[model samples]
Target: MEKTASVSGAQTIHKAISLLKFIARFSGEGARLIDLVRGMEIGQPTAHRLLQALVAEGLVKQDTSHRYHLGSLVFELSLTSGHHFNLADICTPVLKKLADETGDTSFLFLRSGDDAICLAREQGPYHIQTPVVPVGSRQPLGVSAGGLAILSALSEQEAAAVLKAITPRLVMFGNLTTDRVWEYYLKSNAVGYAAISNRAAPGVKGVGVPIIGEIGTPIAAVTLATTISRMTEERIQEIIPALNEAAEQIDVLLRQF
Candidate 1:
């Protein structure tokens, strides 16, 4: 009887996890109790009990209509897990110094869900500028050089999912096919840096180097954006070494954090 009871408890935990995954995948349209019960193929009473447990743990919340949605617990867990580091605190001063030295805009970005969130930025002395991706604004993971750098850091399965999520928006970029994206990822991995010219924005070009973590994963990216006219082959060659050196310094700082 004891062994049977333990098995049942494990099964119950698995069911609850499945329910949470279902709710998270469709967070925009919250799932009702009936919807969850039906989707998870569990009895109403079991579903209700599991949901109550999840709600008590702050992982799920009920709306006025009694539909279930993901709660703040997931966000809290993500922060605690160190998947989302506080880049602004570590990168702000570095970015300011880079901008001052390079006379080109510097940006720090990290992967957040299906978007790359700008965490810090510094403007350059040059009046010519690309549109600033504001701090905390989300950019599609498929288009921006910063986004591609982050995507390239993800494991294959995770990167594929991110690409699928951002596919619809790829239309804005003339011919960005999935094969091209995968090719870019492979190239970026090999070269240790990513670059795009006239793709993210017209007349704007950028290069990015990944800030690798202790475990060799890409934790964030440091990018430099400038007018295409200023990004001549010779100029790109000159900046690549500086960008690489700065990326190493930032990576060291991040690991300390």
Candidate 2:
């Protein structure tokens, strides 16, 4: 029999997160009940119970076909928590300025479970804007500079949980292991910024900074990307100050509502 990993003293939460992740993998079309149960290695009754709870909470929804998909609440929550909406709108101006001034592509990314999804993008004036990570695309945290910045800004326990959750997904990116992500986090934290190579695009590099919440937790990240030939070490250092400024401005704007 295959050994299944369980979180000590938090089995229910673990199972729930696992279920959600499993559903997300197939939720593009819709996830079937038997598939979810088998994929999560949980019994039918337990899966049903969890699914019901998630539906009630508006995190997941069951359609007329008896298949599940992520709910609208997820998108709403991404914008605000008990406040106004327009997260993308709030940050777009800052990103636009960054792109125009730096002559590189700028992106805004938000964390959703163990993955980072690009929320917005601003193309630079440069003729060759690096098509690193496209808007709406999601990838495991630490795969891109913006994601790495968010991961690095997380508290130790939070960061550990995210890393543990995304471990299996990292293999798709060549040589991007858990240890490698941890190393990236350390480096980003030390420099007060994230400068990562191959930001989901080979031969590309990106620099980013986290937008810290009032409690000092990272809520999102802003990044600028270009080809390796354009993102030299000195350039990375030079861009850090501007990136940090933009992140700070966005954080302040977020607190208004």
Candidate 3:
């Protein structure tokens, strides 16, 4: 009986660490308890207990919505470990070069389940500009170019699941029917890239290409976003080659890690 209890205690500690790691990955915006439970596939009581322990350790905190965010302990540990890899590390230089070369905002994004999470962004020199997609902002996979690029790389089943998850929110954007969304993904898959114009955020036009890993699976995406007025078909053609080259570079870098 005592041995079983000891084993259970150790398992609890491990689960607490897993929960902390999950929260750390999303850091600033945090996560809702229900989402965590569903994503982690853990029982509610177990998840709650682990989260409470993490809170006591200052590893997580509950916000107004009762969502959990990383606490000061994570910040302190980041200072010592230097382990946090921000999107800026991999993308700032690439975005700067793209912006300088194309005079358009450059962005980097990654698939986070049903959403595309913006990891990095750099603004262009132009006066008329697209609004910045803040780091950690999440967009549904069928709408934004960055999201579609990631979706295009997913397996059919995975892509379908993501689309189903975000179906309710689709109506708010471009009158996108499910059939149209599926067709878009198919076309994007065929072309190996995706583009969108003023779908969610008005006046912005975006083109995105996936960054594939060593195993030929997508790990991230690179996007070029510009004001609608500046995004002619000729301009998109000019940017595609550069975006593809940049995606390759990022893929190589990600493989190193």
Candidate 4:
């Protein structure tokens, strides 16, 4: 009986942790109970019990609208663990300047496992803005300009491993196979930047440069997003220098860690 009880406790802990991570993926957007049930493939009663236990521990919270989100405990632990530093604080000013200069949206993306998560975004002084990945959104590595930049900055072997992992998720994003991602990486390496036209969204284009960190590893990338009509070859040439310069500045700032 004792051994059986211990096994059950361990399973419950695993389920709760998985649920917490799923909620974190949406950032603060929260997840409905039905969505969680379907996503975790657990019965509604089991999910509810696990969520209640997590909420009691302050690791998760349920809002008035009955949606679940990561609680303050998760953020407090992240700070203490030093897993994610003040990334937004460090990159927002640089992104703002880049956006102002280019008159387009600028984004900062950090590598999180096999995915790139948007950390910050700055909108420029343009009326016809291009819709882009929102803050806290995650994209498979090599799918977006920032993600492709990070992938290209990796060593050949490491990049191949990442491609293998994310290939299964590419179909959901349309036309983004491993072969296409490899092609993008090659183009990004040739120009010292990643440029994608109409990849993430229709009529929306982006260019990005990787921010290399300790021992020449890519910790993140900065990308500029604009409309397809504004992303001509001449414009890409003109903005490459600015993008490169911003990436360098951000790299220097992050190394101060």
lDDT of 4 at 96: 93
Ordered by lDDT, highest first, the candidates read 4, 2, 3, 1
What digit string (tens of lDDT, one per residue) describes model 2 on residues 113-182?
Answer: 6677888899999988986677788988899888899898876666788899889988888768899899
Expressed as tens digits, the lDDT of each residue in 1-257 for candidate 4 is: 99999999899889988998888776556789998999989999999988998877657767667888776455445534653547677778998999999999998888766778787889999887775788888888898889989888876777898899899898877667888888888878776888887666667888899987543456689999998888888999999899989988887776564
In Å, residue 98's CA in model 3 sits off its true spot by 0.9
Model 2 clash tally, residue pairs? 0
lDDT of 1 by residue, 138-245 (tens): 777756778878777766776787788788877777667777787887877677677776667777888887776543445578888998888776787777787777
Candidate 3 lDDT at 138 equals 81
Please, what are the lDDT tens digits per residue for candidate 3 over residues 34-81? 878988889999899888888777567676667787654553354336
Mind sharing the TM-score for model 3? Answer: 0.66
TM-score against native, each model: 0.63, 0.67, 0.66, 0.67
The per-model lDDT (C-alpha) reads: 0.75, 0.80, 0.76, 0.81
Better of 1 and 4 by lDDT: 4
**Lowest lDDT 10-mer window, candidate 4?**
71-80
| Residue 257 alpha-carbon offset, candidate 4, angstroms | 3.6
